[model samples]
Target: MEKRNIAISLPCTGEEEWQATREPLMSGWLTQGPKVAAFEKAFAERHQVPHALAVTSCTTGLHLALAGLGIGPGDEVIVPAFTWVATANVVLYCGATPVFIDVDPQTFNLDLEQVKAKVSDKTRAVIAVHLFGRCLDIDTLRAALPPSVAIVEDAACAAGASWKGRPAGSLGDVAAFSFHPRKSVTTGEGGMVTTANAELAEQMNQLRNHGASLSEEQRHHGPRPYLLPEFNLLGFNYRMTDLQGAVGLVQLAKLDGFIDEREQWAQYYCEQLSGIEWLRLPTVPEGGRHGWQAFVLYVDPAKAPMPRNEMMEILQAKGIATRPGTHAVHMLAYYRDRFDLKPDDFPAARDCNDHSMAIPLHNRMDAQDYAYVVEAIRQLG
Candidate 1:
C-alpha cells in the first residue's frame, strides 16, 4: 500500500482564524457573548434573513427548529432516505416519526415525486437537505407540498449555495447550517439557524439557552445586572461558544473564496473525467449555485472495470483518499430495525449508498493533488 498525501476534506484555516480568536480569549467573556451576537448578525445579513441563531451543532440546530415548530409524538416529518443520519435522528429527538423519501439519482437531492407520494395528514414538516452543497428546488417542493406542511431546509452542506438568486438558508420556513470541519466554511464545530419568522427565532433562541426569558447578555447588561432570568419553557444548553463564534467570523468572511476554489476544482474534475462511461459526475440543477461541498460521483459497476468499493481501494492504494458520499439512513441499523425499513423500500437511496464515492476537492488541495486524483482514477483500467 502506498502512502497518500491527499486528504478527503480539510478546513481552510489561516492566520485570520488565529488572530480572530485572540480578542475573545483575552476578553475572558467566552460563553456566547458579543462575538456570538456579531456572528449571528452577520450570518443573518448574509443570508438576507431576519434572524439567525448560533448553535452548538447542526444536529442541535435541527432539534431546536423541530421543537420550536411544536413537533412531537403522533406527528410525521418527511426526510430523505439518503442523507447523514443526523437529519433523521433530529426528527426522532422531537419524538416525531421520520418518513423516509427517496432521492433523485442524478442530483442526489430529495425526489419530489417520492415526497408527493409520502405526505399524509400526519405530516407536519419536511426536511429538504441540500446534499453535497447543491440547493434543492424549493419551488417544486413548495408546489408539491400541502400548504400546512412546514419545510425545514437542512443546509448543513450549504453555506454559499443559492437557488434562483435566493440563498439556501432563506428558502425554507426554517434552515440549519453546519460549520463542521468538513463543511465549506468551518468553525471546527458549530451551526446556525436562519428564518424570516420572528416567532420561530425567539422560540429557538429560548430553546438553545435553557428557556430563559432573557439571554445572559440581556440580563447582565440591564439596569439590574444581578437579576436572574426566569425559566419559561423546557430547553437545552445548545449555545455556540465565543471561541467558535470568533472563528466563525473569520470563516464566514472567507466562505465565498472557499466555495469558488471548490467549484473550480469540481469543474476540473468533470473536465478530466469526461467521457468516462463507467463514472457519472455530480450535477447542479438549473438556477442552482452549488457550494461544492464534495465532488461525489457514481460508479456503474456494469460499465466500470471494477466495483465501487474496489475502485476506492485502488485509489487508496495509489496515494488518494476517498469515501462513500453518505449513508442511506433508512438502511442504517438504528433506523432499519426501528422502522422496519428494507433496502428496496427506497431503491434510489440504496443504489446511491452502494455506488457513490466522494473524491478529494477541498481548498487544501493544489494542482498537483488534483492531477494525482484524476490520474489515479484514469488508471482504473
Candidate 2:
C-alpha cells in the first residue's frame, strides 16, 4: 500500500446535496421554515419517535433538553468523563453540576456501576453518551436509576445505531443527535431532539426558539397575524436554518447506505489489525448495532514496542491522519478547576484518554485507503 493523506472523517456530499440547497435557496425562506419542519418529521419517523425538533447543533439540543426538564443550579447531572467536552458543558449551561463518571474499558462508555455509586439526593438526571457510535446498555442503566431520575441520551454518534432492536434516540426520555461534518450525516451544522412525550417535545420546541409558544410558521399560517406571542419561559435562538434542514433531508435519506459502508470498513479494520498484539480493537456488545462513527484502536504502551505518541508520529509521517480519543472531561482545566478534580478521581477514563486513537473511517474511503491504514498500523506494531 502506498502512503496517502487519509482524513479521519469526511462528509460525503454530492449533486443531491447541492440540489437540496438550491431548492431551499430559491424558496427565499432560509430561516426555520417548511424544510426544517419536514426534516424534523422525517427524522422523528426514522427513529420511531413521535416528535423531533431541529436545533442549531447537538450542544443546543442537550441544553434545551436539560432546560425543558427544569434542571438547574443545585442539581447534579451524571455524565461520562470519556465523552466530548460538550457533554459536560451542557450541564454547566443549565447551571447544574456535572458529576463525571469513568467509562467501561470494554465499551468505552459510561460505567454503569460507577453511575449507580454517583447518584445522590441532588442527582436529577443522567446524560448517557453513546460514545464512538456504540450504544450504551440503556436497559440496564434505566433499571439501575431511580424512577424519578430522568435519562437524557446523548446519541450524537449513535444516531442510526440501536440496542435490543430499539433505536438509540428512542431509549431515553429525550435524545440529541448531531449532523456535523464528522458524523455519519452532515447538514453543515445542525441537530435534532427526539422524544415520545408530547409535553416534553413541546417544551423543547419552545425552548429552542426564544421561549415562544408558537413558531413563525404557526403564527403566519393562523388567522391572527399580528397577535403578541406568549413567552412562558426562558429560551435561546437555537433554530436550524431551512438550508441546513434541506441538506439534512438529503443526508438522512443516505444514512443507511452510509452506515453500511462504515460497517464494512470497520470489519476490514478488525480483520486486518487482529494480528497486531499491542492494539485493541473496539468491541460492540451483543444486541447492539454500532454506527461506526469512528474506528478507534487502543494502543497499549506497555505492550507495544513503540509509545503511543511515537506510533502517532509514525502514522502521520506516513501520511495517515489520526486523532486522539475524546478528551478526558474531568482532567480538562475548566472542569478540574471547577470541581477541584485530580487524575486519580477517574482512572479508567484517564487511561483510555491517554492511549486511544481514532483511525480514518469515513464513507469515502475505498479498499486501497483501508489497506494503506492497515499497513501503517502493522508497521507501527
Candidate 3:
C-alpha cells in the first residue's frame, strides 16, 4: 500500500452541520438563547443527567464546575499528573491548589491509591479524568472518597464512554465534556457541563453568563422591561453561541455512529499490530464503552526499532500525523516552577508523557486509512 497522510483526528461534520447553522443564522437571536438551551436539554437526555449546561469550552466548563462547588483559594484539588494541562489549570482558575498524582500505566487513568493518599483536610475535590475515552472505575473511586470531597470529572475525551453501565456525565458529582473538533462530537469549540445536583446546576447556569439572575431568554420574556439580573457572584463569559449550539445538536446525534466506526478500526489495530512487542495498544476496559476519540499506543523506547519521537518523525515524513496523547501537566513550565516539580515526581505520568503516541483514528478515516497506518507501524518492526 502507498503511504498517505492521516490526521490524528478530523471532525465528522459536513453539510448537515452547515445546514443546522442556518436556523440560528436566520433568527435574530444569536447569543446563548433558544438553540443553546435545546442543545443542553438534548445533551442531558443523552447523558442520563437531569441538567446539562453549555459552555464556551471544556476548560470553562471545568472552571464553572469547580466554582459552582465553591472551591476557592484555600482549597486543594487532586488531579492526575498525566492529562491535558486544562485539567490542572482549571483548579488554578479557581485559585485552588492542584495536587498532582501518578496514573495507572496501563489504563493511563489516575491511580486511586495515590488519590486516597493525597487527600487531606484541604482537599476539596478530585478530578477523575476519563482519558482517551476510556473511563476509570468511578464506583471504586467514589467509595474511596470522603463525603465532603467532590468528584469533578475531566471527561474531555469521554462523550459516549461509560463506567460500568453508567454514562460519563452521570458518574461523577459534576462532569465536563468537550465538543472540540478533535472530540467525537464537534461544535467547532464548545462544551457541556452535566450534573444531577439542582443547586450546583443553578449556580453553574448563573456562573456561565456573568452571574445573571435570569438567563437572556428569561429576561427577554419577562414583563419588567427595566429589570436586569442581580449579579451576586463573579462569573465569566463562558456561554456557547447559538451557531455552535445548532451544530452541536447535529453532531450529538451522530456521536454513537462515530464511536462505533472508530471502535471497529481501533480493534483492527489491536489485531494487526499485536506482534510488535514494544507497542502497547489501548483496549476497552471491562464494562467500558470507549468513545474511541483516538487510538493511542505506548511505544516502549527500550525495545522499539526507534524511539517514540523518531517513529513519529518517520510517520510525519510519510505524510502521517501523530501526537503524544497529552503531556504530564506537572512537567510543563508553569506547574513545574510553581510547585518545584521534577519530571520523575510522577513516574508513570512522566513515562506516558514521553511515550504515548496517538495514531490516526476518526470518523473521516476508512478501512484504507486504518490499514495504511497498520502497515506503516508494522514496517517499523
Report the number of the highest-lDDT candidate. Answer: 1
Candidate 3 residue 22 C-alpha distance from true site, Å:
0.9
The regions of model 2 sitting more than 4 angstroms off are none
Q: Tens-digit lDDT track for model 2 on 1-381? A: 656888888999999989898877886889999999999999999899999999999999999999989999999999998899999999999999999889987789999987788999999999999888999999899988999899999999987999988988999999999988999998988899999989998888888889999898889789989876799978899999999999999999999899999998898899999998988999777987898889888888789998788888889898888898788988999889988999888988998888999999998888899999888788774
lDDT of 1 by residue, 124-182 (tens): 99999999999999999999999999999999999989999999999999999999999
TM-score of each: 0.98, 0.98, 0.99
Q: What overall lDDT goes with each candidate model?
A: 0.93, 0.90, 0.91
What's every prediction's RMSD, in angstroms?
Answer: 1.3, 0.9, 0.8
On a 0 to 1 TM-score scale, where does candidate 3 land against the true structure? 0.99
Clashes of 2: 0
State which candidate, 2 or 3, has the greater lDDT: 3
Q: List clash counts for every candidate, in order.
A: 0, 0, 1
lDDT of 1 at 22: 94
Q: In model 1, how large is the Cα lDDT of residue 366? A: 85
Clashing pairs for model 3 are 5-319
Task: Name the TM-score of candidate 2.
Answer: 0.98
How does residue 224 of candidate 3 score in lDDT? 92
Candidate 2 Cα deviation (angstroms), residue 155: 0.6
